[model samples]
Target: MSGSHLHSHDHAHGHVPVHSHGPASPHPAQAAPWSILRMTVVSRLAAAVAVSAAMWAVVWLSMR
Candidate 1:
């Protein structure tokens, strides 16, 4: 998330830098633990699969 405002490329003309335009989004990286945990299914494979399926169902319904 870094950039140069006035650099070689823009030096030729005139370039302006910009920052994130809107509200900061929840970083997907921060959710890595829960997401990974959800993916893991050694002893709880059945429950994990069920939860995943339900999540998909909700997402599909909401999208529709």
Candidate 2:
């Protein structure tokens, strides 16, 4: 077999090499009113705070 076998189908199909297909929409999050970005951030923050409180409770109980 030759090195040509290692080549991608993009060239064979006369298609340009695309490194990235960027966001579908310029303002992806804002494009959709029900976008999960805001909810995701809020959930993550709430989880962090809950985890920290749980850890502190554990430490307090251990020290008592």
Candidate 3:
């Protein structure tokens, strides 16, 4: 082995690879209107509440 310290350095120590797809749009100009967005949110919330109420009713009836 050579006494020089230059050839003793390691190459597999610190190396990182980065990957990227593309940029995303925050809000496109052709996006849905505010009224439609409001209706969608309201319907989802209503459905979730209905499901919870139905589950509670079922459990209460079973325990009675």
Candidate with more favorable, higher lDDT: 1 or 3:
3
Cα lDDT of all candidates, in order?
Answer: 0.67, 0.72, 0.72
Q: Which lDDT tens digits does candidate 3 get at residues 1-64?
A: 4785665667887776543432463533555555535667778789789999999999999999
Q: Candidate 3: where are CA atoms >4 Å away?
A: 1-39
Instruction: Give per-residue CA lDDT, model 1, range 1-64, as digits (tens).
Output: 2785665454455566554454476524434445555554674787778899999999999999
Name the better of 1 and 3 by TM-score: 3
Worst 10 residues of 3 by lDDT: 19-28
lDDT of 2 at 44: 78
CA deviation > 4 Å runs, candidate 1: 1-43
TM-score of 1: 0.34
TM-score of 3: 0.39
Global lDDT of model 2? 0.72
